[model samples]
Target: MTAHLSRRSLLGLVGAGAGAYLLSGCSGDDESSDPNAPQTINWWHIQNTEPMLPVWAAMAQEYRTAHSNVTIEIQPLENEAFKTKLTTATQAGSPPDLFQSWGGGVLRQQVDAGLVKDLTDDVQPWIGSLLPAALQPYTIDGRIYGIPFDVGMVGFWYNKDLFAKAGVTETPTTWAGVLDTVRKIKAAGIVPIALAGKDKWPAHNYWAYLAMRIGGLSALQQAAETKNFDTPDFVAAGERLKELVDLQPFQRGFLGAEYGSPDGQAATMGNGGAAMELMGQWAPSVQASSSTSKKGIGDKLGFFPFPVVDGGKGAGSEAFGGGNGFAIGKDAPASTVDFLASLLTVDNQRKAAQTGAVLPTVREAASGISDPNNKIVAENLASATGFQLYLDQAYPPAVGQQVNDSVAELIAGTKSPAQIVKDITTVAKSQ
Candidate 1:
């Protein structure tokens, strides 16, 4: 699910639990502080929903049953609220023992401030079990600071029936091919694409993915590092997107459309009103729920990776995405690492995958993925050579929102290719 930063918000029941202390603290060396001292781990995560929330509670209950000398306190918060509360807590130097982290500039700042634990050595033995792409964001300067539970990517979700109707016999493999397919679909009396202009985030993907395909991963990293996005590669990315926009491919009133509403982007694709949407791993489920029939396109739905640019430096296997992860706080008890180990075990990862809420970070748990579409994504993600975290999550909030807004304007014909990049550059430099 995308917005690793924005997939969900659901309430969960509270559970009280005791704990047993046996694991040693992984890092830091204050002589007087004992590694195995009895302690209560204050845990926080954003899986504030039925299957995950309860799964977490049961795991804590298991720890409580292990011994009488420890305690396990859990706090499950909705996504936005968790971010808000975490900001306040970290500002005060009291982050929970373990908590949700999307890992980027935010987590890097935490590490710089001594608020996060260094898990480089602690997770070494088991960390190799996770997909390297999933761990990319959590590894800072060659050291691990966080652990991923789930990972996913964005791709084009298309209706196979519509593609057949439009005579697109094969999925497009290049940007030019994508344009030709759109033309074919449109000429066949079908709306070629469904976009959520009102939401902005969905539109942001177009420009971002185009930038990736045209300029390669280093282009994005350089833009962030240099506080500039007005490079020729970025400009060409926007120009490429403008080509698509000029095709008049979107549904009427697309500028005002939402993403998951009954008459929005997902519904347009789900109901076969439009051919496809460039979205995240969560698209299919949301499409089903938003459709009038509540069954969506069903077996007619198929996904393809974003097409490559004809003369681009980027590899087709490079992807744009993000996922949910957990970071340890500097002062967390010794046993906290053990507790986390329990949560990420192969058995536990499989259980999480079974619930259909996550794509487990561990490879062995893949068989538990019941959703066929999710299985496809998980398969593709494993072979990905490089991954760019969702732009909104990778950049600071203001810069991220500016990319979303500027790109939306680009699609609306209110901003030019050069203008959007410059606009984003201004915000990035200011930040």
Candidate 2:
């Protein structure tokens, strides 16, 4: 069930009908030099951090100024709550004008439910301009549906200073090596890794990271789309996960820690209470903004690709990620659509990237970024052959809830891998 979109074929479509318009027949008020000409777009997103909150607010203000008639009413929601409200709103036929979405299971489910708009025409001409990894999830059954805003990879983020203290000369490149490295780090009196299991999604991500290494990218996709947990491929992934858990690689009380924000937990690394963390590329942003900003530890951060699981079928470079993007709602006015399209243009996307958000969606924009770490992350995301969407976003909301519960149980040693897989498969099969 893997979907394919070759660069050449996508380029040909762009050339043949590049001028077709999705904005046609859409109308808005004609007034002064205003981009916001009285259009009200209810935009829902969960960006509640000092760095990003102000950044997005400023962007919204700029957007409103350009379109005098348009105003994006920002509705901030918690991650778990947002999903619930989104479902209720769509079911009630009164969803927001534009909402934030992470491509993968969530976007797929929304599109399948007819809760989102298709942007095939608007996306065609700019199709080739995007990196392959940034475009795949938006396409379903050969139709493009949304635009990417932030695209990033999951990786190992380590503290160079901590590594030095532990007497580790180099980062590990294989799962076996990582385990050995973890043992040494712990024996040296430092937390090997910091994990926030309270956030179910991060817990699931740990499993997905291991699954991709255990089953390979294609096999993971097959199991997901086909709901075939009986395959030895997926079973092996579960076993590997159990093995990692058996090692007790995480900090004490990690199973109950919250992860949606970096506020309180990042102090572990800020104070050298922990050595490293395996998370999205955006993780550095948290460390950079930590209480130790005055201590200069931010500059000492290092990143590595997720370690390969030895003897596994997966590629060493394979990654798991989700693209954050904008989508037009069914009721959005034509002018609003125009503003959205223009906002995501190369120039604006470049600013977004520079301002600390990932922007691989627009190659021209990504090229302008000066941050070396971000640049490396952006490049890896671009060259990615395939992506594993965030598990919560990929499955039905109920199934996602089950996944969270399963991971919690597994981590708590209350549920066996076989039982967890069976529980998830039972619900996944229904979907």
Candidate 3:
């Protein structure tokens, strides 16, 4: 979940610097003793997974072995912490040699400030093999700036056990059916859906997906960029969410819920207090990380793309979510960039897929992975007529925060659909 930190807080975290940033996967290998060897390259990433770490570790080790001169220091900062650290490091002129970013506004800021290297020339050969949308977020004007890695979609996850108990056998495929199913699940004494509202970020996704399924992708893109949020199309999307809020599909007091910790709606799902969760393909990883919960959950968990709205303008199967990628800093050594480029090779992507549950941006590397969940997500993403980057990633940070806060208020009953549309428009125009 993305948290809105004050600029001061972000600055403080970033200023904490080397001690905080160097702890992720830094090793004590002393291969730097050779005076003629190239300098060590530091990589700042936010990935810390029990199952996925080994793949990255081996990748780094292999790169080092091949380059001999480039010793890459892989630092794994917590997601939120990484953002703060990155902001500070860049400001201090001590940023990592390469960094992992969602690569829209975040990287754009770095590019605008002349901190990131333009990789248009470097990334071209691999660009042809990537899905076009995966490259959209990282592209500025006409130049490519990052190497695509993990690509996935966001959708709905339901509890098969809860559905069975509610006497619902088939997954609903229409907007009205979604409401009816949630009502039935609630009547069976469970929270119809788990919402991480306090996190604000997850709640923001509700709007993104709603715009996709109800207002259509074009409408979503318009609201994402301009003061056009008050359009009939956008208001219609906001109304759908308002109807859900009135029906109580979300848990009681959900607006007060926290995420990225034990107190979130994800916890509620794990404990069976909720019947469904609306999240990305990464939901499986969350379940997999908890041993007891994983065993107890069994095959009861199921996933489906967001339901289509009757007569909606959008294609039903088009999905919304962003992927991760590797970006090079302006000061990165030539060898460091080469090593990072190799990690995106088909062979390494397939290997990474085995440890990490990522869908390779390259079609060939994706074919090498046999994980069922990965296959389902990859197929859905590939088949999607269009894809929406994460809502926050699609807009400027200030506008994204306003949208997030607006959604939280909408869910909390403090704002009306019309008001939200008006408010978002006012915010967009100011930016």
Best by lDDT: 1
Candidate 2 lDDT (Cα, 0 to 1):
0.66
Query: Across residues 142-228, which tens digit of lDDT does each residue of candidate 2 receive?
Result: 777677777888787788888989899999999888888888888888888877777666677777777788788877667677876
Error of 3 at 383 (Å): 1.6
Runs of candidate 1 exceeding 4 Å displacement: 1-96, 251-264, 271-273, 289-295, 331-335, 396-398
Question: Candidates ranked by TM-score, best first?
Answer: 2, 3, 1
Score residue 247 of candidate 2 by CA lDDT: 74
* Number of clashes found in candidate 1: 2
**Backbone collisions counted per model:** 2, 17, 1
Give per-residue lDDT, candidate 2, residue 394. Answer: 65
Q: List the residue pairs that clash in candidate 1.
A: 3-6, 18-64
In candidate 2, which residue ranges exceed 4 Å CA deviation?
A: 1-37, 123-128, 260-264, 290-296
lDDT tens string, model 1, 7-58?
2212111111122222222222332235445567778886664446666777
**Candidate 3 lDDT over residue span 258-362, tens digit each:** 543444565566656678877776665554442235432546677788888787787877888888888888777666667777888889888867653577777
Instruction: Compute the lDDT of residue 239 as modeled in candidate 3.
Output: 87
